[model samples]
Target: MLIKTIFAGFGGQGVLSMGYVLAYAAMVEGLQVTYLPSYGAEVRGGTANCTVAISNEEIASPIASAPDNVVVMNNPSLEKFQHQILTGGVMFINTNLVESRPVRGDIVLYEIPCNDLAHDLGSDQSANMVMLGGFIEKTGLVKMESVRSAIGDVFKEKKKAKEMNLKALDVGFDYMRNNGGKA
Candidate 1:
């Protein structure tokens, strides 16, 4: 199956890292994968976007002109990429940041209150992992274990963040499992 996903948000929200994790997870699964990232000039105040394509066969494109899924961590990202979601694709929105309705009804939608959840979990920094969890559960792009492995790989040198990242992902998964992609 072809799995194309885009992670977009403000520069420091970990969009590129999230893309790498997904791409790495796909590679670990022995699937074809590609990762591409674009960042605007203002650094933290600017936008950041990354695309990942995964397939069992050769991937025709890595550009994701129309993505099968999108994990949006900010309102601007939602406004910008919401139109690009393919029919039946899944969109994971961070409810803590975005309050707008999804632009496309043809695709599945998952809302996550990443910031609040992260804060409740003791740090506001784990929002990215929470959003990652929502993406995995809603799309089933890869197993959560694979995602967990990816987390290990991505945070290889950042020992302090490892546990929090894992916990955030689990929180996201549990929340989605309990909420069933609603609200």
Candidate 2:
């Protein structure tokens, strides 16, 4: 099995972190994974995105010409990557920040209010985790336990951050599960 996903948003929205955590989780599951991140020179507030490819077999390339999944956290990202999703693929949108919707009908779409959910969880920084959780729940590409473990590994030095992120993840997962998985 193979899945290529692109996470895109403003640099401070944790777009790279989302892809990193997913790649780490895939690694923990013993899957072959590749994560490639790109961002504007301005860093925060600038455009940032990452491509993650997870596969059971050897991957030939790190680049995703047509990603199987696209998680867009902002309107600009949605506009940029919406057309890049493979037909029948999935698109996860952060409804709180992105008001525009994709025009494509071939790909499945999930609208998640990530920032709102994270704010409710007490930390707006955890918005990415919320989106990640919903994506995981909808796709089931990797085990939840693996993601939790990866999160722990990524934030090993910050106990409070780890706890809050984990909670945000759970909230996203539950939100997707309860919302019937598609928009």
Number of the predicted model whose lDDT against the real structure is largest: 2
Of candidate 1, the 10-residue stretch with the lowest lDDT total is 101-110
Clashes of each: 0, 0
lDDT of 2 by residue, 1-183 (tens): 889999999989999999999999999999999999999998589999999999999998999989999999999999999888999999999999999999998999998999999999989899999999999999998999999999999999999999999999999999999986578
lDDT, candidates in the order shown: 0.86, 0.95
TM of each candidate vs. truth: 0.95, 0.98
Error of 1 at 34 (Å): 0.6
| Candidate 1 positional error at 174, Å | 0.5
Q: Model 2 misses residue 2 by how many Å?
A: 1.8
Give candidate 2 misplaced runs (Cα > 4 Å).
Answer: none
lDDT for each residue of candidate 1 in 1-183, tens digit (9 for 90 to 100): 888889999988878887888788888888899999999997786999999999999887789889988888888999998888888888888888888878567887788898988999996888888888877887778888898898898899998798899999999888888888675
Range of the 10 consecutive residues with the lowest summed lDDT in candidate 2 = 174-183
